[model samples]
Target chain A: MSSLKTPSTFIEGPTRLGKAELAALVAADIPDGAFVNLGIGQPTLVSNYLAPDSGVTLHTENGMLGMGPEAHGDDVDPDLINAGKIPVTELPGASYFHHADSFAMMRGGHLDICVLGAYQVSARGDLANWHTGEPGAIPAVGGAMDLAIGAKDTFVMMTLQTREGQSKLVEACTYPLTGVGCVSRIYTDVAVFLIDRDGDHGGGGDGSVVVRETHGVTFEELEGLVPVPLRRP
Target chain B: MVTITQSALDAVADIPDGATVLIGGFGPAGQPVELIEALVETGTRDLTVVNNNAGNGDVGLAALIGAGRVRKVICSFPRQHDSHQFDAKYRAGEIELELVPQGNLAERIRAAGAGIGAFFTPTGYGTPLAEGKEVREIDGRHYVLELPIRADYALVKAHRADGVGNLTYRKTARNFGPIMAAAATTTIVQVHEVVPTGAMDPEVVVTPGIYVDRVVVVPTAATPRPEEDQ
Candidate 1:
């Protein structure tokens, strides 16, 4: 249980991490040599920090593996792109498949990890990322639902709070769920959430959410923000 | 051997009104813009179309949607920064949308082509996307029953094709071409070039000739990179 605790030397202050710093934090946590999918938006920034030779294979749901960094100048190939539709380069040993086989890699548990951007994550690790379930909003579910449910582990990278200062971590996701109990860890600007799936992480021997790390705020402040029952690490 | 034509319009001239069409591409990477433009010229209407995105900008799929041809769209991601045509029509209640999870959409299309009646998948289980679907628990995990999504025609794009229609794609542009080719009753491909029957290396053929019905040489200008269009 002690290993689950936030290190005593962790920096906690009013100065928060910039988006790049947060991305680097998430990038540092990904296991070396793992096959990972980085979702569009903020999660895509995590790719910049990953070394090309880290043995980390990037999977784009549009049908590619071993995706390299963003293409520049003459290296840009419209045919070679990431899930975001931006032109990119292919690393050595890159392979391509059709949409079906690409999704199969995720759904069949062939992918090691997938990083997604979330609107809300529940105490039970429920994910709500695809749609806002709004009246006027156009719903686009891209590969979020698949990435959330299919990958071996799902990690969410987002800001800790809404612009209105509301916590993203809640007791239950009000938005339509992308997957049920699929999130394993969440890396945010303010904290790293370790979700205990059916008492797997010793989160007080229950499937509770634990705060493994915190920055820009105190543990008490973080607890006051989230609506879920939290086990302070 | 497949019928090879030099005209994009001639290639898609037989796609009648009110047909179910599967348009290949992930965004615009592999979208057969020439074939879609020809479909517009045919003045087709009341179509049920399936693709990854709804449309982007005022061209290709967007142009067809703007021309009031599509009655329904079954796709995973329909809303994007440049999806004005789909957004305007959808908000005005002029179109029907069935939003499937990406994985479910792909597998359903694959199942339709592979002759599978239905299969259980864990992709959208326990989410709102699984509404009215049957869920089964196998080995302590839940999966929902998903049906196939077959189509009357498929419009695809590939880098090159042999005389008999063996296809080879370029990079990620190969996204949905092969699967859509198999999932449709008639598959029409628009390629930049048509080579001799034995020209293309057999080992590199992404989509076999059996799944393809027709091929057209669009004579694209040396694979020029288009503007930054997502």
Candidate 2:
């Protein structure tokens, strides 16, 4: 196991939940018969923690439905890959279709859940994941925009704070937005946040952010760590 | 009658300069590499090529761009780690790029195939991508108008093809091939093998023969041959 680095701030203390633990938390919340699309990078790990009989049908935007877990060794097929280009297995009732059809499912509001990694999620559930708007950034926006707006519920998986000890759950996203007010839940290493359009914190009436769960931190500690005000659920 | 070309070069000979061509693939998967090589060999220039991602490494569409054949590239992910050629060229203003969001790109091509005029999508609304475009509000949600993307020719790759050009793709390699086939005026496919017309199961054919104009069988492990060897 890799060593955990100490966080710079003591407001919320340090999070003991790593990626696998965070993924497990998210995986446990996905209800049965949910059609889920796991985005690239960290969100893909959610598949590993799902129960064998979870009855969740995984979807890949590249043109696959009913996807199974990641493939290993001899089971890896070069042509059978997810949107991230990683080899994955297909479930018993898996089906393949045209690329356009896959996007139609994504943008047509057919997916029950789409879990994505984010750079920042605003207090009003606005998502800023595709670009940081930094100088010389490549700015490759793949399918995040479609999934963010089209999924029935959008969930973000990331650390609550940046490596520089900045809170990602912000009053306003500094980064370029991928979608406006699309995130429903955020699953971070420190806690789970439920964001809604309640207009509590007064950033032009965007929305309010509330803590739903925490690993080892209290609501006051989390609020103190965050740059903006956060309410309790 | 099945129109089977003797070689990739022969199949691509009729593609004129400045033709709008749709090359199917996401990265290198499902890319008609040999057909791209043939296009390079055919010396077609001033091309507008469309695909999902820009070419990877220094081959396929990247090689074509490096060869100074392409005038413009329409794609979503144009700058991967190995896309140095496109990056340098785009930075130097040698080639033009129209970056589309991946889903929007796919939908545009599919719209052309499905004979749709235009559609409103919420993917690019409230962003730079939605700038200077028609925006509408339906049920208090914003959507931007996106038009269909059609091409004069489409180059695609498939796992197998029937003698009459019915094609079936292999796994995830099917990425943009089927949609590109439908969106182009003339679709040319590179396949591993071509069987009798009735050999393939009708249920498994992803692209029916009506959309395919030419079929070229690419030999496994075949490399670009020198002019002298040819």
Candidate 3:
């Protein structure tokens, strides 16, 4: 249980960790041959950190499967890209499919794990990724809904709190819910916490495991990476 | 119509006060900066805006909130960015806000495009979203009623287009532009380049020409940037 107390759970950091540290941390959870969806931003970094020898296969919503991590500078492939339009590398078995079929894979629950970026996440496991309520904003939802529902396990990759000093993990999201009770776990800049699946906030009553701080650092040190000091509800 | 170098007022001259406009983009990406810039200069007020995420501050759709022109906002997540005016107006109840789950909003607009009256989904079952909305159980699972979404004007961005208006979007920035194009009465597109007819591959055309009404070329504009991509 003490080893679980890793300091930062984010993909990027000022800590400038070695690539092996990053890959080892992520690869520990990724089972062999797990089908995973990598979200656009920081979540995408996980692909690069996935251990090379692991059997993890990455699926991109934009229609690539068996994707490998980012290529070294000499090996960058210009034509192959991820949903973020960033040039990436593909594993030997990488396959391309029609966009429709790709979406079907997402909506039909074929994905085993999906790491997402969120604006807010409730303690009840609701996700709010789309829209933030200002005027002249772009009005649309990307493929987030399909992944939230279709993935066998939904994990959120975000700071535990918002830049405005608000906790993303809440009793209930004030914003609209992306998926009701779909979140399985949360990885933040500070620590890793699993949702209390059992209905009890204390971790044992319902089936939900209580999330404890993994790293030995101060909550402020964790918050500094995420840019928000989280207060649990 | 007189052409001025970046004529601010002339751009939005046709958009009347109190008109409901749907702007395209997922987050801050693919927003019609030209139209928004023009809307700001034209001093139009009392507009109902629909979009994904509001622009942060002094950018994107959030700029309208900063200008205090939006009367109402129909969106999903409106509290992500820190906009003083958005927070102030929302707290004071100065603006009417209707929040729909992200998927529901997309499907509603897609339904509008297909001319389907409404489609049922299980997104908001047994929750606040199911409140007030009609619900029906299908095979033991709950479903919620979602109405189609249509806007008076749709503003979009594209990487390339033809004279007749087939569109191609830069990757990532191609979030809501094509969908909003189908859900609006009049669709205006801002493009980086307009190529000769038949230049763009038919297979690559994202939005067909039938949905586009007007084209506004952004001269010397680089590719549209998706805020989340970088």
Q: Choose the strongest candidate by lDDT.
A: 1
Model 2 misplaced stretches (Cα beyond 4 Å) = A1-15, A198-206, B221-230
User: How displaced is residue B54 in candidate 2, in Å?
Assistant: 0.6
Please provide, for model 2 over A10-110, each residue's C-alpha lDDT reduced to its tens digit, 9 standing for 90 to 100: 23335558999889888988888889999888898899988888889999988899888777888977677788766779989999877888888988888
What's the CA error at residue B121 for candidate 3, in Å? Answer: 1.7
Angstrom error at residue A39, model 1: 1.0
The residue-by-residue lDDT of candidate 3 on B98-176, one tens digit each, is 7676557666777787799987777656555558888898896567888988888888877788877898876435656
Between candidates 2 and 3, the lDDT winner = 2
Candidate numbers sorted by TM-score from highest down: 1, 2, 3
lDDT of each: 0.87, 0.82, 0.66
lDDT per residue for candidate 3 within A136-212, as digits (tens), equals 55333456766776687788877666778777777677776667777767766556666654443444434333444
Instruction: Go through the candidates in order and give the clash count of each.
Output: 0, 1, 19
lDDT of 2 by residue, B9-95 (tens): 999999999999999877766778899989999999999999877677778888999899999999887867677878878878888
Q: Where does model 1 exceed 4 Å of error?
A: A1-14, A204-207, B221-230
User: Which candidate, 2 or 3, has the higher TM-score?
Assistant: 2
Model 2, residue B224: what's the lDDT?
A: 23
Give the top-scoring candidate (TM-score): 1
